[model samples]
Structures are given as structure tokens and as C-alpha cells.
Target chain A: MIKDIMLISELGELALIEKIRGYFSIGDSGVLIAIGDDAAVFSADKKNIVTTSDLMSEGVHFDYTYTTFYQVGFRLVISNVSDIYAMGAVPSYLFLNMALTGKRSEEEFDDFLKGVREACEHYNAKVLGGDLSLSIKGDFYSATLIGFADRVKTRSGAKPGHNIFITGNTGDSAAGLAYLKYVKKRIPMEKNMEYTSREIDGTILDTVRRHLIPCACNPETFIDKIKAMIDISDGLLLDLYRICAESRAGALIYRDNIPVSDGVRAIASMLEMDYMDFVLSGGEDYELIITSDSDHLDDCILIGKIIKDGFFFVDSDGIREKFVPKGYTHF
Target chain B: MIKDIMLISELGELALIEKIRGYFSIGDSGVLIAIGDDAAVFSADKKNIVTTSDLMSEGVHFDYTYTTFYQVGFRLVISNVSDIYAMGAVPSYLFLNMALTGKRSEEEFDDFLKGVREACEHYNAKVLGGDLSLSIKGDFYSATLIGFADRVKTRSGAKPGHNIFITGNTGDSAAGLAYLKYVKKRIPMEKNMEYTSREIDGTILDTVRRHLIPCACNPETFIDKIKAMIDISDGLLLDLYRICAESRAGALIYRDNIPVSDGVRAIASMLEMDYMDFVLSGGEDYELIITSDSDHLDDCILIGKIIKDGFFFVDSDGIREKFVPKGYTHF
Candidate 1:
């Protein structure tokens, strides 16, 4: 006798949700009611509630050729949680909406849920409630993160003359993408199709991990020192431009001061591509670009200063040039 | 000179978002910071924050054949707002995520936004923040609603001997769908491809309006009187079964007491279909089903009684039969 493989279509909506809910435990004291309720109920103990939502669709935002099911689930949590952190909030609850195409097995769904559960545990957040549907096209995932903050941060709070700082190194994710493309082109092995972490070298794996699971800065420790901040999602230059446009200011960036990791530089050189392009234009970095009056702060490197008029960048030779904004756009 | 028609693809993500944002105003005092930020900040004055999210895809959940763009936008808001209402909450903020296919005109986008704005205005809710992306499929819309509730309601609170009641009329939306399909089949004109309100008769139009623009009950006004509440999105019998399963109880529904509208009966007779099937099995009604000790409620009609052990239905001849649960499932 053979045991049948269960598909999501066979489990139906409510039963599949029950299977997904089995992975999550409502241990948070703030959560009054969870999964089966019409809407999840939680205590809002803070002064303000900060909410953020993001949507990721297969073929549009991600391709299975370079990503795994677990990575997809983990990355979705990171994207929404990073937004909460950028607002000077500690993420508390998450609501997920998934549209599955029924091509995946039950084991794949379980692995995805496991990734989501692990990420929520890492951030001290709980899965509250969500909706699931069948998709005719492909898989789509949406996450809504709700958190609390005592001091809320907005993009319009930066002033002229404030120093611009960025947390962690930039352009690592872009270099990872380029390296993955290069590896796929160079290696003619069938195992490269899966792109598992063990199949690659340590240095390359480190860059790929950074690309897949980027860390978010906790704003509770630095909320007072920062004036305005935005997550480096659409690359450093475009995000900086957003902050300036919102705050009614401009910026002057030092090209040499932009932080780029050694691994990124090595990969860019191997690919015969300029490393500066990745630092300035490549996106999905998930680091925070902060502006403040003080420059020296823990885990932050100063790269520029907010200006009152024009956007410019000073090269290594001390020659200032107009900075052209370039980054990823959905359309 | 010919004026070029603006497509969503031409404006890109940020520019299209700017156009959508122009239709809304941040008038709510709870909205501290809206749109243009990484996340939206709102003041949660109540004891608990209620949150619900729903997703609607173009071909899966709806089609342009029978519904307009404005109706799609309006129904999405209604779906989420109804969930919050079922939790005895007043919806205050909404975050939308839309994946546009780049096939829609600027005027169509504006009309959709207009529908969202009008619905928000009607419910005293504000559009806070959202994400927009290019869709490889048709189109997808996701709504995340955050609201405040003094006392939260859940499905597990129903007790045995409690009287079950439902607000508004049942089977209207399902009947409307049947009537729309009938009209399309009867009319041979090309204009029948798009079902507008003016193309149908007044009786049929009333049912179609109920299907398109649903009204959610404000549970805040009567939260103290209700024991358990769930929105009727998956038909009457299926929703009742969910409540029973969650509460660890059973229900005894009276077949003759289930609310059915005159328009529904008329349309059912015209289509030569059983009206009882529409009332019990058809979904998307968006009505609130409440269980309480007292049957005398303001806008609700008593239809059933919670039982201790098994689910059954009593016919008009006073014969009790086993009730088999049936409704919509998105598998």
C-alpha cells in the first residue's frame, strides 16, 4: 500500500490553515485572541502602533531558480519586520496572506511555515491571523506587521547639516545576486539548480545568506540619537533621495566613504563590474540609512551630510558631481 | 493633436502611488504619520487593537465581466471592515497592497481609488500606507485593517442554550449573482459583456448592489449583548458550523426562520433554482451572525439555538434532521 501525498488543494482552506497554525503557539502575553478569531486581538500597551505591509509575488519579486521555499518565507518576515524597526518599533504581531498555486506538496508548506515560525521567534513576535486563497497564476505572499513604539520616527524629521549614517555594509546583496548568476553560468552541474547553502564555498555562502536573510537594526537602542531614517530597500542613493525629498532637503555624499564589504568588492572585480554601482544602485540591502546631528554612533558609519539645496557626490579626487538617482522600480 | 493615454506601466510604482495618494486625506486624529513613510503610525487609544487582512485576485476571486473596478475596490474594503466589525471593533486605519498588471488606464486606476476613498469616508477610516508592484498575472489586491475595540469578540465564546441571530438578509448576494448570469445568457448584445447597474431591472439591480457594495454591522454599538459573532462570508450553514466547532458546541437551526429577501426569492424563481440552496450554501453575504441569550436585538432576527451535542435542523413540519455543513472553500 502506498501513502498518498497531500496537496494544499486536498486539505482545503480551513484545514490547511489549521495545519499551518499548528506550528505557531500563542505564548505572547499581549495576544488576547489569535488564529481562529475573525480578527486577532492584542493589547496595545505602547503610546503608538506602527503598522507596515508588503507583498511578494512569484515571477515578479522572486524566482524559484535562486530561492528556496524556506528562504521565501523567511525573507517575507524580514521585509515586514525591517519596516517596523525603521519606524523605531519592536514588532509584536504578524498577519500573513498567501495565495498558493497547488503545485507545492504538504512538506513544502510545512517547511515554509517552519521558517516563518523561526523568524517570529527570533523577533519575539507572534503569528496572529491571516487569510489563504488559491491562485490561478502562481504563489503570492503578503505580510502585515504591527508593532509598538514610544517615540515614532518619520521620514520628514531630518534637517539640513545633519550627518547621514548607514548601519552595516551596503551592496553585499547585489554582489550576492551577481555571484549567483556567475556561478550558474560557470558551473554546469545539475546540483547548482537548487543553490543550497552547502553546495557553495564559505565566502560565497556568507554573501548569499546576507542576500537571503538580512538583519534589521533594533531602533529601541538608537531611537533618541537618530533624527530620520529609512530602510535601504531600493539602494542607498534612491532611499537617500526619498529622505531628502520628504524632509525638504538635499544631500552631499562622499563616494569613498560608502561602505562596501571585501566579499562584495572581490565578487564585483571577478565579474568585471564596477563595485560602486552595486553600492549606489543595487537594492535589497535592508540596512537603515539614518540622519542625525552626531556622527559617531554604535554600528553606524557616516557617509554623507544633509544639505539645504542640491544633491551631489564628492569623488575620491575631491571633485563634486551631480548625483543621478537610479534604483529598482516595480514598473 | 492626439493625447496619449496614461498606463500604470508608464508612471512606475512611486508615481502611481502618488496619484492614488492624492485621492485620500489624513483626517483621522489617530493617524500620526501616513503614506510616504516606511510604516504608518496611529494612536491606539482602546485597550486592544483588532487586525484583519484579506486578499482578492482578479480571476480567482472576481472577474471584470460582471463587476466594475469601483465595485472591486469597494468590496475589498467591505470584506476587511466586516471582519473587524465581527470582532466588535471600529476600523480606523487601512493599508492596501495592489499588484497592477500595467494594462489598466490611469482613469480606471483613479476610479478604483475613488471607490476606496468613498468607502473609507463612509466608514470613517483612513488610508495610511501601502505598496504597489507590477503583476505578471492579472491583478491582486490585499487589505490590512487595524482598528480598536473595548471588548474583543471571538467564535469560542458561544455557550449552549444561546440564541443564534443574524443581521441583514441572507442569500441576496448569491441570488444577485444568479440573476447577473441569467441576464448575460439572455441578452445577445455585446454590451452584455459588461454588466452595469443600469442594464438590469430594479429588482435585480437591488440584489446586485447588495452583492457589490455590502454593509457591515457596527458591533461596537451592541458588543455587550453578543456572546459570539462571526461574519457570514462562507454562507449561513458553513459559518454556523465554524462557530459550533470553535465553541465546542452544536446548533439547531429552524429551516423556516432563516432570513431570505423577497428579491432573492424572485430571482430564484426566475432562474428556476432552489432559494434554500442559495441561503444555505452560497457565500459572500458579509452579514454578522450573533449568538446571545436574549433574542430581542435591534437589527437581528433570531434563527437558531445553540445545542450541547449534535448539529441538526428543524423543518416547518417539526421534524428534526441531521445538518450537513456546506459552503464555499477556496481549495
Candidate 2:
């Protein structure tokens, strides 16, 4: 049986906004005005505000054939919230901007909104308000996140002799992409089943879920112990290089100490690719990389140490190799 | 002679960011961390922070054929800053998001950035940081503006007997658009010359400039007396209807009191159209429509009065006509 789909145009702009407003409950104590206003108002609560925005465009940041609208919306919030967490701040508000091509079904858009609502609830954040417009080519989703922190961490405070640590595992998102490429052609089609519910290999499924719902690190618990921090969006090597360049320092990473999941390794082997490449240079991991004193290695993997000058990678053979930075570029 | 045009791919991402960074000076005492970080951090100064974001997509919100890149960027800042001012806040910082199709010339992008910088300076706002990505079709510019205010004006506070007021003139933008459409077929193209510098009739030129650089109304001077407020993006009657719907009140607008410019009147006559239609339904004026007590009418044009139930327009002949809400919609 085919499912019924509705177009946003049929609902009109005001009705569409009303529908979106219905998805979010905004009784939060700080939100003064949420939807249906010129601008949303909220209290700052006497803390420094950290603001960030990111844009994801069709055919540039995503391909809808392999992903769903829900994942698109969910990942946008996660990606933006990750930046706030990187600064040891708690995300409090979101302003979403969506440009649609007018070809989307109402169900798809609803699923996208549901994903956004769920993500906001997960992070204790509220959707203040945003603008929606029509696009000529494809969909564009831009998210602006506002966060608060008493003391914020920046990328310019890492000093020499600080230990480098990363929360959770890396390379799983890249492995998920590789696994999807390998098995996409072999999977049987089921029109009614959602992508997440489709039957797949268990090992590959885990990695795929990791790609779809990449976790964000909350460094607020140990913010005082951390010196500098950044999110791993453009791969580990490139982000580490950014920390080094910003702080006027360098890093020495231990290759064996880097965290790589078993599912990622298995998928990399199945795809005939080097797992270390994914671990070192894969983007969109959304994990936090922190530079801290040795006394504060509580809930993270200690993978390296800050150096005085040049970036290096210590191999299993006990030889240090100079590392060159290369990763994703929007251009 | 034809001028040289450089594509974004030739400059790469990092160099493009560096070039963009050079356009603005960031010695503002409020900015703790500007660009080159995961997110931008600024001091909120113990005041309520007002945040708003709007997206302008090519072929939807604007067209390159009739408008210049500089105008596009300038209008974007104006439109966003208007929202801040509508909330009776002072715009302080900007986070810009651009999605390029990799086909834009260097000079064109520079012109757009120049417009943004000038607008920022004009409003005493600083560009903190933003994200850039590739687009499949045309360019998309999404801006998030942060402002500060001691008190805020929302659309839910207008009560019956409150006087309706507006800042500056309306309908000029729509008239300018009509004039552009009228003269575009007659003008001869000059290579390498910007559209704003092109020859045009003086009467229409002022209206066109009004459309391009729409001014925002700063209401902080009398925010304490304002009951409800909204920016006039989607016509006079429609936005008034929004204020009415949100505040649960109706409005009685005097048709003769609606501010229409001389250039708009002339163009309306030449085009055989009603100038009031443009005044009632034109979008992109970026002016403020405010409702306040009679005691706080300072530096504004009084146009109407809030009523208890239904919207009506009183003609010069003293006939009350039911006002139906109609304006721009994305769909």
C-alpha cells in the first residue's frame, strides 16, 4: 500500500508554520516569545552566550537517496550543538532556516520536523523561531544554536605538555558510509519500510546508525580541567592541526592509541580500505578533542600530547612521522 | 573592456575565508572570540539577548537579473536587523551562512561581502563567524543577527484603544520593483558596470534605492511605551493583521493616513495601477508597524487605532470597508 503525502504549498505558509509550531512545546521558563512573533525572546541568565550557525545544502552536504529527511534534520541539530559542547557550553536555543524546492511531500517535511523536535528535546533546547523560503534547486537547512557557559573553552589555550584526549570512538561514520556503498545495491527494496528499519547486516547497521546519529560530547562536566577543545567535523588530523595553529603549539598523536570500533574495522576490511585512513581523516565524527593537564583524564581516551612546534604521529614501530593536514573543504 | 571574473574554486576555501576576514575590524570590546573558532563567543552584558535569523535564496527571495550582488547582501542585513529593531533591541553581532554554487566570480562575491560589511558598520554590529558550503544551484545567504535589549516588545501585548504607528514610508519597494520591470527592457547593457550605477530616471532612482537599502527603524527610544510591534516585510495590511491575530485585537486603519511616496504614486499612475494596492500588500519594505499608547507618539506617523474585534479601513469619504489580509508567501 502506498502512503499518502501532502505538499507544503497546499497548507499555505501560515498553516505550515502553525503545523511546525505544533511539533514543539515551548513552556520553557526562559523562552519569552517563541513562534508567531517578529523575533523570539529569551533571557540570557547572566552567562556568556556562544553562537554558531551551519548550512547544509543538497548535493553539497548530503545526498537524499541514501539518507532520510529525519536524519537530515537530526544531524543538523547534532552538528550545531556539537560546536556548543566543544566550548563547554550548554545549548539552550535553536533558530532553524529551511529553503525548500516545493517538491517535498508533507510527510517528508513532517518527519524532518519531528527529527528536529526530538533532537531539541534530547539536548534540553527550544526552537525559538526561523524563516522558511522556497528554493529553486533543492532543500537547504541552516541551523543557528545559542548556548551559555560561565567559563568557555576556546582553541587558543592549549599549551605544550598538555595531554590530548578524545571522547568516544572515531572512524565509525566513514565506515558507515563505506558499508552503505557496499550493500546498497544488494538490499531488497521495500517501499513502506523506513531506512532505519530495513533489514541489514548487524555489524554494518551499527556503523550506519553511528553515521546517522553521531553523538556530541558534553565537556561541561570537566570543563575546568580542559585547556582547549574542538569538535571533530573535518577529521581528526585537520581539527588537531587547527588547535595547534590557533594555540601556537603542536601535537604528537599515538597511532595505536586512537579509538576505532570493531564494526568500523570490519566494514573497512569488507570494503578493502585502510581503517586507519578513516580513523585519522574521516569527517563528521562529531566527537570532542580536548587538550588538558594529565591530572584530568577521567572519561576520555588519551591519544596524544601537545608539543612545542610540529605535528607528528608516533607509529607502532616507535618512529615519529611528520603529519600533513588534509580534510574536507566546502569549496 | 570586459573585466576579469574569478571563480570560487580558484581561490579555495581557506584563502576565501582569509579574504573575507580582512573586510571587517573586530576590536569591539564585547567580542570575546570572533572568527577562526568552532563558534563565536560574545558578552551578553547581563541584558536579554534577542536573536533572529532569516534566509534569502536566489530565484526565490531575489534575482540577479534586476538586482546587484551588493544590493542582495545589503538588503539581507537590513531585513535581519529590522527584526532585531522590531523587538526594540540593538543589533550587535552577525553570523552569516552562504551556500555557493562554485560558479560565482571573485569580484561579485567581494561586492556582496562589501555590502554586508557596510551594513554591519551602519548598525554597529560585528560579524563574528559563519559557515560556507557548496550549493548545487544558485547562492543562498542565511544570516543570524544577535541583539541586546533591556525590555522587549512582543506581538501579544496590543490592546484595544492603542494607536497604530509606522516608521518611514511604505510601497516604495514594490513601486521600485515595478519600475525596474518597466525599464529593464529599454536599458542598454554596459559591460563591467554595476546595475546601481546604470542610468535611470531620477524619480524612480530614489525608490529603487529605497528598495535596495531599506532602512530599519530603531524603536529603543520609545520601547517602553510600545505595546506591540512587527516589521513590515509582508505589506501593511497583512502585517497589521498579524499583530491583530497575535494580540487578539482588530485594527482600524485610515486609508489616507497610510504613507505612500511621490515616486510610488507617479509610477502607479504611469503603470495604471492603484498606489494603495502596493502600499497595502507590498513586501520587503523593512519598516516597522507599531502599536503604542497615544502618549508615546514620537518621531512616527500615526496611521490607525487598535479595535476590539474586526479589521476595517476607513476611506477618505468616511466609508468603513472590511480589510481582507493578503500578502507575500513562500509557497
Residue lDDT tens for model 2, A1-331: 9755443323333343344344233443354434332123344665566777888998777777777777788889889889888877788777788887766655566667767777777787666667777788888999998877777777878999999999878888877867766665322212223444445666777777777766677877677888988898888898888888879998999888898888888888887899988888888888888999865567899899999999888978889999897666665
Where does model 1 sit among the CAPRI classes? Answer: incorrect
- List clashing residue pairs in candidate 1: none
Writing each residue's lDDT as its tens digit, candidate 1 over A99-197 gives 777465554565566566667777876666567676778788898888777666767778998999988888888888788666652221221134445
- Model 2, residue A224: what's the lDDT? 82
Q: List lDDT for all candidates, in order.
A: 0.73, 0.74
* Chain A TM-score, prediction 2: 0.82
Q: Rate residue B275 of model 2 by lDDT.
A: 88
State fnat for each of the candidate structures: 0.31, 0.44
Summarize candidate 1's per-residue lDDT along B209-293 as a digit string, tens digits: 6776767677665679999888988789988887887789999998788888888888999888999988998788888889999
The alpha-carbon deviation from the true structure for residue B73 of candidate 2, after best TM-score superposition, in angstroms, is 1.3
Interface root-mean-square deviation, each candidate: 18.1, 17.6
Q: Which 10 consecutive positions of candidate 1 chain B have the poorest summed lDDT?
A: B185-194
In candidate 2, which residue pairs clash? A6-A106
DockQ of model 1 vs. true complex? 0.14
